[model samples]
Target: MSSAEKGLRATGLCREFAGRDGSVRKAVDGVDLVVRPGELVSVLGPNGAGKTTTVRMLTGLLLPTSGSITVGGYDMVRQRRRAALACGFSLGGDTGLYPRLTAQQNLSFFGMMYGLRGDRLERRAARLLEEVDLADRAKDAVGSFSRGMKQRLHLARALLHDPAVLILDEPSAGLDPQSAASMRALVARLTGEGRSILLTTHDMREAEELSDRIVLMMGGRIRTESTAADLRLAAADRLGHVVNVAFADGRVPAELEHCPGILGEERDGGTVTLRVTDGAASVEWILKTFPGRTTSVSVTPPTLEEVFLDLVAAS
Candidate 1:
């Protein structure tokens, strides 16, 4: 499929709400985004930075004040019904399952909404329950399931129609390690089947692990969007290529912020913790400057957390 047909596209997206003070609050501001089929893109931002608002607009829950959105080749606004059927979104709280209904019944109910019935609905529900590791509990009421179990059920519900695009908001929230891992695996599996996924998460690790591209947002606008490797390379350029340090005798170097390529340095006892720009070449210079005083040295990979924080800080 072509780029526009593969997934979702939003251009010049903006939303404004009348504030309590009778002023306008720009919840989303001129954001542009694209997600391709079989790709998992993570949208991230600080609180009130328009992440949820953006999702709401993309999923057709709210209309954008300006700009256009398309999902699975359908215009989100002008072709609302087609767009709604093309995407599945779970906003992460309750599973929206009927608590009194058995797991099988709940799945069947949602399946029927998607026009699956009889043997097809039963087969699909059974397969989905197994996919979510809830086959054993299919006959039990959803209320009897754990929080994690409910979350998985929600995933199954979202997948009932086999939407071409999936938007998951904080899918791993409140899940235990095993449950969260399962959810991530499921997301990966769906994307492998050529389904596009737009996921939002406060969990940095989840974003780093699952997203093909990460979009960092702050103050209701995107600060940057790139792959994990691209973000690290960009941050390295700003931070520095190398760092050299000298320590005073008897006392380790105190916290010092020096050098064009160095971000910051902290001292503990006789050790200096340096946050350097680049790893390979910077270590060579550090060894020459400190010599024996350096004691020990470690080179670290750039983490998404670091890049994300730096982007937000710059914004």
Candidate 2:
């Protein structure tokens, strides 16, 4: 199948649960998600946003109350075996690992479940350990490994089947800065190899850095879906523009604090960031009003986290 036809897709996906009082609550309400081949889409949301429920449905773990899911052209609900075979998942945190087993042993076991056997399973297990930088620790029991090491093993297990689509739920969570960076690099490499990836993460930087598209989901529905740049721009339009200014004497002047066209201002060390209705006017006002206090000024889009909070709060 062509790349366009070989990816993960969900249409009108919804999952509802009955509360103790018989009140039905929708955990996921008509969420439509897609990750094209060679692309990575990140889903971001606050707590109880139905992200977990949606992912479970997509992975065939939990059945959707309504809607359809297709992974690599196979119906997830009807052709479950084929859909499962077509997609792999790395669900981070404490899940699906034999703490007493060695890394190689763990991979080998999961590989067999994927129908791999004999020398093929052994070879794939070895290669994957090396790929995740865990070859040296392959013989070590998983229980002894660090959180980051366990995360890498989860990734290796997910890839053992060599599926066409991958789903990662906070693959970098609990890892140190260096380990997180390494995990992100591996995720990026997987997309370049033409595998579609659907990632759900709370880390704003991770979503912004690795995702081709960022999906903002809240109240069990997708509020916005766009590229990082476009999302930032859209958020700016919905709210206001960001103007970062560094003072000339490395000090913010009190006189320029409540200037025109400036919606709000925040001081960060030597730089003063202003949220303005007009980007050009804000910069001009700062320069013309107090040219001596301004050393450098640039209009830039709000950060991804900023965009996320602004949109979520507004919604």
Residue 81 lDDT (model 1): 86
Q: What is the C-alpha lDDT of each candidate?
A: 0.83, 0.90
Q: How many backbone clashes does candidate 2 have?
A: 0
Best by TM-score: 2
Clashes of each: 1, 0
lDDT of 2 by residue, 112-191 (tens): 88899999999999999999999999999999989999999999999999999999999999999999999999999999
Consecutive 10-residue window with the lowest summed lDDT within model 1: 252-261
Which pairs of residues clash in candidate 1, taking residues 3 or more apart in a chain or in different chains?
A: 240-261
Candidate 1 regions exceeding 4 Å error are 20-22, 239-273, 286-298
Among all candidates shown, the one with the greatest lDDT: 2
